[model samples]
Target: MSKRVARIGIFIALAMIFSYIEVLIPFSFGIPGVKLGVANIVVVTGLYMLKPQEVFFISILRILLIGLLFGNVMTLSYSLAGGILSFVVMYIFKKLGSFSIIGVSAAGGVFHNLGQIIVAAFILKNEKILYYFPVLIIAGVVTGILIGFVSDKVIKTLKIQDFSENLK
Candidate 1:
């Protein structure tokens, strides 16, 4: 239990750092609310390195900490929606067995955007936000591919010989 908690803590820390790093970069698509999703690397890594439940646990911690540190209550909806949706997609990818991290992360990106859209629609009580879908999907493609590629490189360099190898 302590080991799992420690892993979750590590993920939260990395996610916070990446989230803050993104804030400093100030890069955005013209679409109002889009980001590079740099912190997703940690989520993707958790999905690949541990069980689905463990990955979910790490994700909840990361999202909570990241949101608390960088955002207020309103922004929490976006992160919560996006984080949960991406985690689900990553779990599906984990089940599929043959896809690359890039593919899986791309899926995560799409789901993340979709989740935010869902939340925006619910919170704002408007369906027009759905129009932002295309731009969000494109942005996801760009960011997700990059994050996944970087994650793959990092995982390779870490030399994790098997899925459970890093569990210890």
Candidate 2:
């Protein structure tokens, strides 16, 4: 139990670090809600190594922590919506057992953007925000593929199967 807790702690820290790193990077597509989402590398890896519930917990915790430290209410709300939606999409894809990490992550990224756009439209009471959906979806797929590749490498390097076995 302690070991699982410790691992979850590590994952949260790693996710936070990735989020911070993303903030440092100036890469942007001039589209709001479009991002490399490097932090999702941690989420993708966790999905493969940890239980779904544990990964969800870590993801939500990371979002809350990052929000408290560097964001306001709006940011937190957008993040919560996107994170929850993306996690659900990714988990479903993973459970289907037909998609690779890249596919699952790509779906997650698209849905993440969708989630944010939905929130934006709702909050601003303007349907114009939906116009950004297509661009964001493209960005999501590209970034999701990249994130998935990195996650695959990380999983292979860490021998996550072995770690999961040890935990079991």
Candidate 3:
């Protein structure tokens, strides 16, 4: 139990570090809300390597920590929505076990954007926000694919399944 708790702590820290690194890099593609979502690499890694409950816990904890450390209320709202929705979609896909990691991650990226946009629309009370949906979707796919490939390599190279057994 302590090992699992320690692992979750480590994952949350890594996710937060990645979030900080993302903030350091000025990766603007002329889009307002687009991000490389480098932090999601840790989330995806958790999905592949940990149980669903653990992944959910880590995702939310990372978001909360990032919010408290680096963001404001609006950031928390948007990120909480996106993170929870993305986690749900990814969990479903993981359960289906039909899609490749890339597919699942891509779906998660798209859904995350959608979730945040939805929150933005609600907060701003402007349906025009939907106009950005298509572009965000494209960005999501690109970032998601990139994160997915990196995660796949990490999972394979590290032999996450074998490592999971040791954790057990």
Candidate 4:
């Protein structure tokens, strides 16, 4: 395989490992389901370094890997909705705006939760699910911003621009 493809694989594997780690660090905010999204570091790094299409591929692959390992087949719908929405939001920001890495990452976090809420609404077939929208959106906004800030710090401290440039 090409060096570039190998790099992609390595990052994907790293993403999976990070994701599993997130799963284990359970401090659920007592909200049934919420997280700090540390695993998003990989996604943010990939987006900053790779093209839009490549980022999309990484997002889907990571989601699939996580779902298959710990999630049921029925959960694919949630992953699909969340992953696609998150990618679209981040890609739009990166392509059309002047937001830094953290900004895009934050937006992706919000978008991911929005997507999952949507999936939940559809799956449960209940309009009451709309009630959770506000809470989840709040969670998304806060978590997104936090992770974005963290990613920003990581990028600056780690000199990620060099790697990003090479990957591109």
User: What digit string (tens of lDDT, one per residue) describes model 4 on residues 64-136?
Assistant: 9999998887677787798899889998998877987767877898889999888888889998987888888
Candidate 3 segments whose C-alpha is farther than 4 A from its true place: 160-162
Cα lDDT of model 3 by residue, 100-139, tens digit: 9999899999999999999999999999999999999899
Query: What TM-score would every model get versus the actual structure?
Result: 0.90, 0.94, 0.95, 0.90
TM-score of 4: 0.90
Off by over 4 Å in 1: 160-166
Error of 2 at 70 (Å): 0.8
By TM-score: ranked, best first: 3, 2, 4, 1
Clashing pairs in 1: none
**Order the candidates by lDDT, highest first — what do you get?**
2, 3, 1, 4
lDDT scores of the candidates, listed in order: 0.83, 0.90, 0.90, 0.80
| Candidate 1 structure quality by residue, lDDT tens digits, 88-123 | 987888689888899999989988998989899989
lDDT of 2 by residue, 67-135 (tens): 999999998898999999999999999999999999999999998888888998899999997888889
**Clashing residue pairs for model 3:** none
